[model samples]
Target: MPTPLYQRLAAHYRDAVAAGSLTPGARFPSVRSLMAQHEVSLTTALQVCRVLEQEGLLEARPRSGYFVCHPAGRPALRLNEPEARPLDPAAYVGMHARVSEFIARGRQQPVKVNFSGARGAPELYPAEALRQAAGRALREDPELFVRAGPVAGEPVFREVLAKRALASGMVIAPEEIVVTQGCIEALNLALRAVTQPGDIVAVESPTFYGLMQVLESLSLRVLEIPTSPQTGISLEALELAVHHGSKIAALVVVPYLQNPLGSVMPAVNQARLVNFCAEQGIALIEDDTYSALLDEDVPQRALKALDRTGGVIHCASLHKVLAPGLRLGWMTAGRWQARVEMLKYAQSRHNDGLPQYAAAAVMGSSQYDRHLRRLRATLNLQRRQVSDALLRAFPVGTRFNTPPGGLSLWVELPDRRDARALFAAALAEGILIAPGVMFSNVERYATCLRLNCGNPFTPEVAAAVQRLGELCLTRCRPGAVGSGAAGSAA
Candidate 1:
């Protein structure tokens, strides 16, 4: 008889490792999904993964699931060779720094309304309460305040966070938690912990661009799975990528209210995704950054809540609700907690401890939920405002998604208009919007742009939209001159 399918999978993985194609710290396919892809049973896939684990090619990380291990003494690989550029300190700043600069000093004309942020209005923050909490933390716990914090962050804060997760139906424990500066750092840590340079990671086609920057900085090969604005990446497509021996280190996804597009995966898809990851022995990083803003009668179940095998690394931050300035984010890495904590120690120990205390105080005092409720109401109102504005302002042929909640709206421009150019033109008119090109790994969303709907409706914002409409009209006209003119400098 021919060698069994499980044996074949084990051999394929073994060969990939031997050839250094999969590299170290890469993730394997989930078993249930793999079974579906290969038309095999769960038992066979599990046996294959077990064989690989026993052979030392795969090591299981808690909560993170199984990953290819770096052989002892493997030097940390440098990702990309830095390019020579003008001697400017600002030029070397990372993507977030550039984004921050754009937010602060880039806009020349002062529009009446601001739509540049994917956040609730600044007024949503309980400024007085936070200031009081921070002051109280300093005065009451000077010992905790004046010391270097834990590598995973403060215990009491993490406990509070765990309780919060439990209340939300995520079943996380404090020990599995690692608080970070923000959701971005949590994402960065999980990526760094599981992936080495040259590893291929799978992501949604139109994912958060910042993550693409992370992958590029690490010199990781990116496998883009076609993502639907309504449901998420085709699960079948992802399964195919995994079965073809793609050395995917991890799958980073925002299952609830994904950025830019604002698409949320249904609960059934979420369960299938968890089962697939568990079956394939792969790690998943579930970013729930925007889930807190929903104001629906039926609460959607997070992917982490349905995870039976410890494969989903759940992450979120208080920034979207309580305050972005607080920069308080946490992750439950399940079995990957130790590795993630180690990386946290190696990175910066932690973002800041006092902020955690302040955040916990606000969250625990019952004020946080009330604040979130008000925020949801406000966001809902803004969501309608932007939706109506987009439909009314854009050309009749334009298309976009109307997400139930979240700050950004993904708009597809008519007649293949370059969003980058639109972005430049909008900026020249004292408007700022996220161009669609920024959301793709391969820069494929040139005809799209992400507009922030979190900002309140104001006359200036409406005027900016009208100006943007004029720009779109000009671009859509045939034989338009100088397509290259649209960009940040436009």
Candidate 2:
């Protein structure tokens, strides 16, 4: 499922184009120059240029060389972030219904173009390489097929994971890491280890639906804290919530490229969060699912990396950046490592050993780094393309987040138009979209929607976006009150 090397080399120019460093009509580097600069072979150089041309980023003239060709004249969008809400503790309810209905509708009807979930294309995953790795492992240890693995994951896989965790700014012992089915299971184990059934768990307003689902499944009440569309959850609001006596047991947060909003918490905020959680005796369950998708300059700033008190339960998955089919995610439970491992054992024993072997082989080898690089590159291009499409299709005042990483766009419709209405209309037209209200347990952000940019921005998708805009213009106009969607969603 992984992309070719030419795609990796093409990602360099793709980054430049995404950053606007290489504007429309800007000439591309010559093939010979690219070969010399990247230290690639002539064939790779040609393939890179070929991909660029095929993707419409470049056009070749009769005598002249390749030059940039992309969407032009799209106006720069201003940030119209959601209003901040004070600490309001509420229980999770019917969230799965909303999300399930959206999913079920897509399945029942034929979805022509999907913008619902933030999932990557198969080309972004390293499947063939993983197959080869699995083959090598099988040949090396044919008995592994019959042998049962450790209850806390194979030591070799844990060692590889611990070393890779260093890149996220945390030095971990392999013993502290328990490989789970995926990040979801890791999150489940963390929550189960920390709190009882009725205990309250704090989360950001308009948080990831999956997290809400987890809280619901565990019978945990939710205390909603106001979060910024730019920086992430506000520490001041959370402190006031806790100090005001919410009796919050744990805080489950995504600090990097958070889903729906696509916000990356700043380093200072990360430090403050860790310190606050530790001082407050609150278990900090940090989801590093999107940590690998953070911007290059801010890559090392994970909440766990700032944890000096070992209070942060760091959870991460290789499912997104590595082989997508291989369900491998690990978590270091810090002080609760024993409890987490016990919960994991009681729940599902351990992940399959064949996958562990394959994952370890891939992680230890050089292909892991290559997969991450090309994955980021491909995601960057997809984001840019989708952003351009949105700008061209949606009306003025339709605000969206342009994160340096991740495959999400939290779009606020013009004049507070109804996002659910748009969702229904888009579904009728065979296009799927995630309504913003689904992110919140209560009715909020009805004017907002999340668009996944993982797929290629095809002409058909561009047309679907245009149609969706037309629906937003006509179906959900701005003029109502009491319904949080029309009034202040603060």
Candidate 3:
């Protein structure tokens, strides 16, 4: 499809804003002026501004017209990121119990507002469409309900997955893809295929807690690599770690829309990391759970796309943007394909046939593409609203990453505001949030926390956020800190 005229114009303006040519708080041209300058219809001009407005680049005023959304200098709503700290020494896992305790407490003390889990808004899910797809699959092969699926995957689902992999610039046959219970299982099998107990593995600092939990279960030691909030894992730091003799067996990373942090790795960075891993003989296990949430214009961020040595183990599932309940995930294990497949079977055996066919039915249709577009737009809007609300609701000196597109924002409390205290206070009031300490084993992120933008910004949610902010002011105690910025520097 040709690029929409409004989108092209919007991209142009977005670049100008990012380049500082159009500074923050600058006035946007009027609709008539834009039409005259671009020689387009009034509707096209209006659309360009509308897209910018939705993206938080431009703000519309009733009579003052549109200006830049974020003001030049206040700490609120800025994109300041936390300072990258030094890499800590490799160590065995110890956070699983703390996370479990936090979760258990929440189960006992249920909250009114939940910002803990990264799930999409209820309206974004295509319930009726999924139902129809399930019905079609059932009618086409009623025996699917009774028979076991192939150990790799149902052929229909694998075919669709192989075709869909092209979006990440990956070219793989259906046989190379190993279907699993979910993304979690794919990650587990990939790690198991490559490493043994007591082996050392590399993971991004403040990575998805699930990866940490998995490492803990496997009894593997971890080497935490510094990660950037804007671009993702630091290649220089990874090289430094490896150069200094950190015998890493494998590295688990999320190159696009990294969990908790919401960083999108640049294309060059992805290629370089792939080459580094391939040359060093390190298994690059990629968690691609959130890459589908990005726009089509983004560079092919998947490490598997540039994997020539067959070192990248690509893992992903539809839970983030598609049917969460489907429990379908697939992976390509590169040179370890056979071993990973065997591990998959030995671990869980073949998956059930019914859901695979149903997922394939929905994913094979044009409705899937339409659903992706809608889903991306919804996530972008939610991220923006939640970021804005955080700035408005949180205390001063606060910092946050205004991720380009994702379901959560990494928030740093201002004036030594404590996240654990916030978690405790919020829990008492029935509000839930993911504290930053759970994300890392070190003390660096003790004051930081991640807020899920997956839920809609309803009146109740907004009030809960406001209350949470009030709690931060009342319950949080001050302490010495190393450093912090106004917002993400992405």
Candidate 4:
């Protein structure tokens, strides 16, 4: 598979912008000039220019040609080394009040700029297509709305999901799949099936707050293992904890494009983790929510694919990549399938049939594959644009690693700067951001923050980045207090 000509041309300019060669506000060549210089067709030249513009590296004036819009800024931040010590022993997960308040404010107040939520823009979804699919499903089976379906979900939907999972290297029967309201439900069920209250669960430090909330709700204690921004949770730390008699009941991890940090576990590590979990008799709860959004040429296999001992429980959803409003998610619990199914049935009888039918129709269509390709490209482009913006906006000494694929960028600010204060300040300006405290049970990442990169880099978004940069600079100055009191008034 050779690289497309337009992509090659786009890469040429992208490299220039990344380097200092083409400085900010530098005008790009005209379409005709580009064609002549590169010996390509008019269509290829136009596509190349469009790709750059979409990437936020170039802007087009009414009369002027496309010009580099990204300013020369500090170098990319260095990766944060994984912490070596064990996490602070905590019985409960805190920060519920703060997170609740943030959510309430987002709903009540009219935000000028939103950088908080991880959901993609509504326009990015295939809404009309899904609507059509729903209508077709309803017309095909008018009785679907009137009848109750199985607790394991609609049989047809599960069949489609089973077929689709094959692409990710998961081999499972339709009977083994259980549909839930969302991935959260699947995770909750998985956790409930394996362990009791007071049991210890191992999680990546600075993991998703929702997982912490789940642990808290279940009265489960957590052993936060050291995790890397590029490689995910450390196997050595995990083995040490197990060897030191941590008595870990289960391990919850996002194997591909992990949230917050965006780390993807290497294949070798995935194999090791599966084998280790099996040998230790610990159940592994794998969150595969973002797996479908991977932008890489060769998609990685799910952790469930290597489960020979039936220890890997896979949880996934389509909300991140497809129709979020559908609220459809599924899971395949290897050895714990029966327990998970029973728990799901007791909690919620079954998912709604209409949405499941609609999802099945969409997933079984060729259009779904096309939509994923476009979605992946758009997300990758947005990730780069946001990374460039962050590099230009934040002060020196900031640290972060560009994730291979995902919707977020985890940023570590200067030691003196408190991200909680930055969050409050940014909120006061009507720009929402997820402070680092929200992601961890402990206060390990107080100076860090996670930025959402699911949306496109429009002019409004660009201005918001600039404003956030200005706010950060102000806080970095001496005598600055980060109480975030200003946000309370708003």
Per candidate, the number of residue pairs that clash is 10, 0, 7, 0
**Model 1: worst 10 consecutive residues (lDDT sum):** 84-93
For each candidate, what TM-score against the reference?
A: 0.75, 0.84, 0.85, 0.83
Write the residue-wise lDDT of candidate 2 on 1-490 in tens digits. Answer: 8988789879988899889998654468888899889888999999998898887787774455776764544443434444654444657555888887877888999888989978787877888888998898899999987888898999999999988888777888998899998899999999999999889899887888888888888898998777676688878889888888888899988888887778878888988888899999999999888877754733466788888887899999887777668878999998898888888888999788889988898889887777777878778877877777776777776777767688788887767678888888889889999988788886667777899888877888789888887888777766422354433332
Q: Which of 2 and 4 is ahead in lDDT?
A: 4
Model 3 weakest 10-residue run by lDDT? 481-490
Off by over 4 Å in 2: 1-74, 82-85, 480-483, 486-490
Q: Which regions in candidate 4 have their CA more than 4 angstroms from the true location?
A: 1-71, 476-490
TM-score result, candidate 4: 0.83
Q: Give lDDT per model, in order.
A: 0.71, 0.80, 0.82, 0.81
Cα-based lDDT at residue 53, candidate 1: 81
Off by more than 4 A, model 1: 1-114, 297-299, 476-490
Using TM-score as the measure, which candidate wins? 3
What TM-score does candidate 2 reach?
A: 0.84
Candidate 3: stretches off by over 4 Å: 1-67, 71-86, 295-301, 480-490
Worst 10 residues of 2 by lDDT: 481-490
Model 3 per-residue lDDT tens digits across residues 46-155: 99999988887887755558876653334344434435555678899898999998888889996798898887877788878878878888888888767877899888
